[model samples]
Target: METVEFKGSHDPEKKIVVSLFWTVRKTIREEGCAPVHIKRIRTSRNVYEPEGRKLLKLSDDIMEDILRDMEMGNTVEFEMTMGTESLRVLIDDKRFSVEATRTPEIEKEIVEKLEHETSKLTPDFCQTFLPRIFPNQ
Candidate 1:
């Protein structure tokens, strides 16, 4: 069995984390794994103060957009606004902006099996296996 992992983080103020995991299974199966499974995790935290009511509203708006986009199978694009004191997330070309006294944190994780050739499986062999598993897309 073999495995690989990747991790990265962006600014804590608008904190973002991304991770990917790959694993090998079943030595008999060529490449150990015929296909890869992917999973993602995202987290956000916001703190509110008396004067930060507006910022809280913004956070809610952004979170809503993120959830909607995920349901629609879309990616999120992030931007800065209000002199970098605020953040914006775009979904399906629509943008939502928010301000917060304390920046919110965001994290994402993905785990999947990769069809990497071991001594038993070669790149040429994967060509035949991929089509059967991923017929379309």
Candidate 2:
């Protein structure tokens, strides 16, 4: 399977994942595909700057949670899939980690383990969620 990944230094304050998590949340809700649920997380800042890219806040508890997920060997990851394309984001460390991704066959397995569903959406969803990434056809 073809894959694209974004690797970056982890944020100890857990702000990176917070933004990543919200990105997944926004994609899922706006896509309106499979049933996916998310916690009502409080962001340090508004996602939309009104004229800029989305920004989010990282919290202490989120860092703890990421540690726990890694400790359990099941880091909190999300998958977003549309047709043949997909994205998979993983945030399991503060010192260093990766970002989001799309749902693959492992969705069921991950969901069963974390009690979290795979956030999925249609191809059209990308047009809105990531216009820069997937521009209009």
Candidate 3:
């Protein structure tokens, strides 16, 4: 099997974006395929608080839940919040929500994987992937 491992530092500025990207990339690579493109949507600001942190922890716990659904060749949804801040990601019909937090170690692999997968896409493919992955904003 081809194992694509990613390593890097988790700079807060781009941690979440990087992590999500890598996760998608790793999934594609492990499947011996690549995505047409990967789009990243960043909230205007970071939301951090005690309650929000707890929720973020929960979100992390559900990472496997998110991955399993995605692995079924189905789209997965994610709703994330930090303090009063929140964002929702809808892939096909699957959906879930949680609070956001900074986790550099995990984010590093995610970002790298995303970059690797996206690098395989053609411009035309990216055109379609971007809109679908990030819709309405």
- Find the candidate with the highest lDDT and give its number: 2
Q: CA lDDT, every prediction?
A: 0.27, 0.34, 0.33
User: Any idea what lDDT model 2 has?
Assistant: 0.34
Superposed on all Cα atoms, the candidates' RMSDs to the truth, in angstroms, are 18.0, 13.0, 15.8
Tens digits of per-residue lDDT, candidate 2, 1-137, equal 22222224333223333334444444454355543222223223222111233322223454455455555544355343433324454444422222224434333332232222121221112324332221231
Over 4 Å off in model 2, which ranges? Answer: 1-4, 12-15, 18-36, 39-62, 68-74, 77-90, 94-137
Error of 2 at 31 (Å): 3.9
* Candidate 1 similarity to native, TM-score: 0.21
Sorted by TM-score (best first), the order is 3, 2, 1
Ordered by lDDT, highest first, the candidates read 2, 3, 1
User: Model 3, range 1-137, lDDT digits (tens) per residue?
Assistant: 11222223322213233333334443443334432222222222322222432223213324344444444534444444323323233332122122223332433443344445433422112333233233332
Better of 1 and 3 by lDDT: 3
Judged by whole-model lDDT over C-alpha atoms, candidate 1 comes out at 0.27
Question: How do all models score by TM-score?
Answer: 0.21, 0.26, 0.27
Model 2, residue 46: distance off in Å is 29
In model 1, pairs of residues that clash are none
